[model samples]
Target: MAENLEPTPVDETSNRINTPFNRRNFLKYTGLTMAATAIVLTGCDDDDDDTTPMAEGSVNLGTGDVGILNYAYALEQLEAAFYTQVVANAAFSTAFPSALERSILTDIRNHEVAHREFFKAAIPAASRIPDLTPDFSAVNFSSRASVLATAKTFEDLGVAAYNGAGKLFTDTGNGLTYLTLAGKIVSVEARHAAEIRDLISNGDFAKGDSGIIAGRQIVDTNGLDVALMPLEVLQRAQPFIKQTIVATGLPTQ
Candidate 1:
């Protein structure tokens, strides 16, 4: 039944913009492939889940690894919604839309959708975060700077959250599989972060001047990066969620 939540249909032609594409450009921006067989299929029914609905109210994610995973899932839901809206309602210039810009947006949209779906599939029962209606009314879709800046914020925040939560994952209990998946997803998220950064300011690949200058360091190994724990990220997302989330699932603490 989880598959019932299919992504809203997209209007390709209307949203299309002519942008250039090159390996260097492609390397600069990396995101998940949007085209997938997102079909409704018979899966485990979560009808019996007792947790409150994500949109109606908040449910403490409980304490422990499960809680951390749930927290990450909630954030993913937020990012996905933002990108979905961006693709559905894109901005363009009077000149032929740049091929690079159009391709990047499309890829970003797809990546967000894939990440959202992955979380849903991983924890269908309790991972549905309330959908936040994006407040892009203030953003000029026609402006590349505005759009890419927003993208940078989301991507950077995502990487930080995952890094902070990685240590909390219980490798002993959940099996290494869970940790492996997290690493894979986080790597992809880091790629997104770097790409967004490049768009905002060329030659400004990594703000964090980590020793690993061989490549960009989107997320530095810091205790609490500003982008990592942004309360605004939560505030902008609160409109979609009605209740405060609590951490749950540890041995009665």
Candidate 2:
């Protein structure tokens, strides 16, 4: 029998910072509750997948609406896996040595998992991407600096990805549900990024405005957040995951 892949209960205390907009607001606005779940982590090895691994080391994300949904799915899977591993490892406690940090990380983990599950359920099973194995060998979770730095990276990347992908949902005869949903999630990601940034360096939120690269930077000159095409986001993320991602039918413009 296949094992159940539900999220294990989180016992740590999580203090939701005072913010008018947050996950609570997100749920209220999106009509989402904390009841549903998300993605699973596959093996880190190349042979881990039940389906044939990608040829030439590249997995093609599907095209059009499904393609767009799958793209978000992939990122959420990565984030969920990274946080899951981070909190589970003994090193996390030793590294941060703060109850608040651990609690916040756990909260982030649960949120990412829900996001992952949302995408998995949103897209048809026929078009869904396989569970991905993340490569975190370079993360050095034992070190507080390393872990926070990586958290910063993933959070910022997520913000940029949603910013870029949002355009794909614009007025293409499709209803605004997906677009609205994307907006809701991106705001959450922005919050996560800000929190992580403050943990790393005070006032380090969205450096894109201070003359950083266009898509790679977290925010732009207009105080707008960064955006990256799917290919660009995937390329930047490739190093973190063992599986190679191929964007065959995703929109480019």
Considering every candidate listed, which one attains the maximal TM-score?
Answer: 2
After the best TM-score superposition of candidate 1, give how far the Cα of residue 179 lies from its true spot, in angstroms.
Answer: 2.2
- Model 1, TM vs. native: 0.63
Whole-model alpha-carbon lDDT for candidate 1 = 0.51
Error of 2 at 90 (Å): 1.0
Candidate 1 lDDT for residue 142? 59
Write model 1 residue lDDT over 203-247, tens digit each, in one string. 675676431222435544663333333233344445544356544
After superposition, the stretches of candidate 2 with alpha carbons farther than 4 Å from their true spots are: 1-57, 170-176, 207-217
Candidate 1, poorest ten consecutive residues by summed lDDT: 35-44
- What tens-digit string does per-residue lDDT give for candidate 2 at 168-191? 853343333566678878988888
| Candidate 1 segments exceeding 4 Å error | 1-59, 90-96, 126-138, 171-175, 209-253
Instruction: Specify the highest-lDDT model's number.
Output: 2
- Please list the C-alpha lDDT of all candidates, in the order they appear: 0.51, 0.67
> What's the lDDT for residue 84 in model 1?
57
